[model samples]
Target chain A: MEKFRANLMLCAGTGCVASGSAKVHAALRDEIKKRGLEDELKIVLTGCNGYCAEGPVMAVYPDEIFYQKLTVEDVPTLVEEHFLKGRPYQKLMFKEPEKKTAIPLMKDIPFFKHQVLRVLRNKGLIDPEKIEEYIARDGYLAAAKALTEMTSEDIIKVIKDSGVRGRGGAGFPTGMKWEFASKVKSDIKFMLCNGDEGDPGAFMDRSVMEADPHSVIEGMIIGAKAIGAHHGFIYVRAEYPLAVQRLQLAIDQATEAGLLGKNILDTGFDFVLEIYLGAGAFVCGEETALMRSIEGKRGMPRPRPPFPAVKGLWDKPSVLNNVETLAQISPIILNGAGWYRSLGTEKSAGTKVFALTGAISNVGLVEVPMGIPLRTIIYDIGGGPKKGRTFKAVQLGGPSGGCIPESLLDIPVTYEDIQATGAIVGSGGMVVMDDNTCMVGTAKFFLEFTADESCGKCVPCRVGTKILLDILTDITEGKGKESDIETLEDLARDILASSLCGLGQTAPNPILTTIKYFRDEYESHIVHKWCKAGVCRDLTTFWIDEKMCKACGACLRACPSKAIVGEKKVPHKIIQELCVNCRTCYDTCKFNSIRILPAGFEGDPYEFLGIGAAAATTGEKKGDA
Target chain B: MPRLTIEDLKKIKEKHRADFTLREGGYRAKVTVHMGTCGIAAGARNVMTALMDEITKANLTDVIITTSGCAGLCAREPLATVEIMDQPPVKYCDLNDDKMRVIFKEHIMGGTPVEKYGLVVGSETTY
Candidate 1:
């Protein structure tokens, strides 16, 4: 093996690649070759480093210096200054939003510090394309241990003791599910891996598959051994071309290395694996629907008196585990169940990977312990909401999940705790929302998704979600009735009660949760005909408060419709008839001078409510008065 | 790549031990080659190249090689520092390729500070 003094682990994950890591990679290679430093300094294109918002990012090992937002133009300065002169380039180092000092090390950055990497242990450290690098990190040792040393009963017992639940949203105990399938006598059992990650704003599974493809493969080998299966299939969505390509490469590498195919590790354990591409249907993420899709049928759920553990994937007893759940299996098998049980709560042991997106400052992937508070993940790890915005709520579990209000921010992230607040810790997609986001519109946005993805397999989820989406649309557009709230609640409950599979059952969670927590926002839209957040255009009317306006002409210049009329030293006025309600003027004003009133309001907003102008723009509900 | 037996897995792990040590970190010693303008002008690049060759030749993965700026001693020209885990750092001054190779053998591999080449025992406080 060739040795280099320093390794530059450059991120080439899908996020960083889209942000132009490829150009930077080419530039680095060209510069390194020109300088004759290729022998001394090696460049390794590793997977996601998780701080994706700062791509294209690179971490220089041995020194452990972290550089973010690299462009090809900056590469010359970086290689010359840091790689040659040994002085780190200050321009690319990560600077905190308010602080002037740049954070140099990856471990010092809060986004990377608070995370505990178990499933992502090899992320950004080893090259995903190289099997040698994976083996160097003790990759297949666990599978070797499981196959050669441990019996099927022993593997099942160790996993049951670990208390790891499925990470595909349902939180079912993986060991119990494996035990069920292992106990049932069958001729040929199938070990299936669910990689059909359909949730919006979620990429945990895609990253795991792309970054550490071998870990997933190694995990499947151990799982196949545990369930006494001889064949397996990994069902990935077609949208993830990079993940699919990398996983296929890994599968081919493992097979050639004799780690995957017949007589693996010379222990006479044989297991074959294949990759099955999903058509990007949202419902295929469900276990039964995924099994049907693998069997080459239209992806829809069937009633489960006979679960997949009994009659799955061609009427054979099979064990289907999520990509994340399978990724964690090898680590538990290698380190023992007690090692896996060290971090999380007794009931929900081990860490979970979350894709932090939406209105947060740090949009990336993170793995936190199971029992940590949501406030830590949001405020500490995610850097809170974007600048100058107050946190309103965080939507968890995609469409099947609910929004958690600020009051429940301190709740521990255990499955039970989050479920008690009407949200499941499903697949760890946390979309942080700010004060500018309207709760009614937020519910409507998720309903639009679930309504489109209800699969039409069951009436309650199909027709009931459509009816709920229509009512939410009405509420956001200022056409809602007094009885509409009750109607939405009653209908959401009916869908929750009589839906088949996990899709329709939890589809109404967003509507139900928003009505439970932000009921005042709902009433303000339905009765007062006002969207204080100014998000619902039909219910929103933007106005300039004459007393607060500075006569700066900032709003006048920003208005696309040329609705604002003002001169030097004169407060601006918005022509109601000419205004487009685009909120451009509201956002452009430096001073807090813009006020939102109910649609078609024709009087002075302060005088109509008999309140001070100062209190009017703070999103207070003055309509009840 | 052929089918790897369990023994082959261990061999591959041993071969890549240094790469992982640089990343995941359990290094026994750290060597910092000063690469300031003055140091580079005074054959510091030769010393650095020598150090890299010796580390690779010896297959010492637990010993990390890094570079730092000038140590504020331009008179010394080329300088290097070796700090084993839990020990005070030792700085060697006025180094060349031959002197660096000797230092790698006696001090880095043998774990003894070469008294003739050594200039300082600990780092100066910046604050």
Candidate 2:
């Protein structure tokens, strides 16, 4: 970057690609060539820039000026003004949403300001396709050090001291996992890197594999040496074709550079890496299930005790770690364990990458330190939901993890702390829910996903989830009774206790947590047959309150069902049978005049408010500290 | 390529270290052209040609030039940020051939920024 006057880093990751980064790239190349400034200016296509919403993103090196939401048409003028004149592109910098004023530098933006980039160190900085760019950033230097200077014993101890746990949902200590495999006396033990990121809202693993393929390669080679294994495979989801493609390219580059394959680094340690793609099964994320899939068997979780560390990947002593956990290896090995320990809390050391999305202003990936509070992530980092709507809860761990209510936002993010709040940091997918989201509806959605993806290896997950979903569907559709609540709680506990594998064991999390926190919402559904957010269409009805109605005629115009009957500047009445429970009028009414009433409301609709407006007081009682 | 040794790895790192030297006596001057679509639309290519022609005409080997993606301020698309060693980066905005030529001759070569075209002096960008 310093050798060249400046470098144009164009984001080539998936988000930017969807937003037309390829056109931007071609336009840039053509523009640079036409100017004959090819030698003077270097154009490098980098990976995910993290600021995904306003992509295709680009940043000028040396000066570190940030630009986003670029299109092909903006190329010629950009090349002219920026390259010819030494000036700041004030219009292209990240604009503050409220002020609509551009923030020129990357560090000033709230999205990148809070993140401590260790795993994502190469994000938006280096061209992932070029091994040379990675090398220049000291990519495989850590692996070289481990092979030549440090012993296998030293590698394990440094990782142990660093306290980096498995980032693939389960927070098992990495050092301990490595130590177990290293001690095992086997001729052909394997180092398996799990890239099967199946969580619905999670994409951190995908970003890492796409952005820093060499880092994963370097980590695997080092892990292989430490565990006394010469053969390994990175089990990535078949759905992640780009990740698989990038890893293949990186493997070729590393092999060519003598960093992988007969990796002498002049040392006799010979380690080779390969890729095995799973058929996009969620259960394949489980270590044993992934191994079985690699072995050409059905991807389903088996019982533990003979955990993958003891017997894994073709019945050989092996070590399996997540893509993110492996990326952390090179940094820990290069910077030492103490440096890694400095960033996070005592228990949860190092940073966690989260795919922050759903009802949030900043829709992208964020890697924050483990000790940061949820309130900071939601408020400071995420900009506190989409403006006016209040923050309800954030679904932390997909179907396998539970939701954390607003009251517990003060709790620091750690494996133990998150678990205490009925959610595990399961691969860091923080889906922020708003006031409009129905608690029972949200729970049912996650349940439906697990029920669909349940490998069906055991009865608890296969049958238990089915039954729980049926009850939730009944509750939402106004066919439920009070007895169903206690019945669901009992059934969820039974499934947790008797389920054979992790899938079955964790299937009841969404239902259990929703009932635990939002009991009043569930109670409202059963007793009054009401849905507060109008999400449960069957139990809900819409009516315009005559007192508050400004007679704006907004509801009549906006109604998709055309059920509302009214004249200009007059209060409207919803024709009941034609209403179709659409709630279009409710959303369209600006005067807050339209309200939801239960379908069988015996009296005035004004008196019968939904559960969200009712006394729903079942979450954490303490104020955020 | 031959197998890499510890010495070879060190040499590679050293080369990179020198190439990416960021601070103090690191380099004489470095200029970045914002080339993201936003900049391109704002005529960054013309800026590149103008800057390149001037650099060649001046026969200046000390000054380095490069291109970057969008600086995000698409409104003032044509942008150039200059970094001189031991000094904060200066962003000169809405650059065209004439304004850039003057900046290159006076600010880049003579160490005096053209006040009118310079959007913000120093990289704090606090506002």
Chain B alone, TM-score of each model? Answer: 0.95, 0.75
Error of 1 at A430 (Å): 0.2
What are the per-residue Cα lDDT tens digits for candidate 1 across A544-589?
8888899999999989999999999999999989998899998898
DockQ of each: 0.74, 0.23
* Deviating ranges (above 4 Å) for candidate 1: A607-625
Model 1 in CAPRI terms: which quality? medium
TM-score each candidate.
0.98, 0.86
Best by TM-score: 1
**RMSD for each of the candidates:** 2.2, 6.8
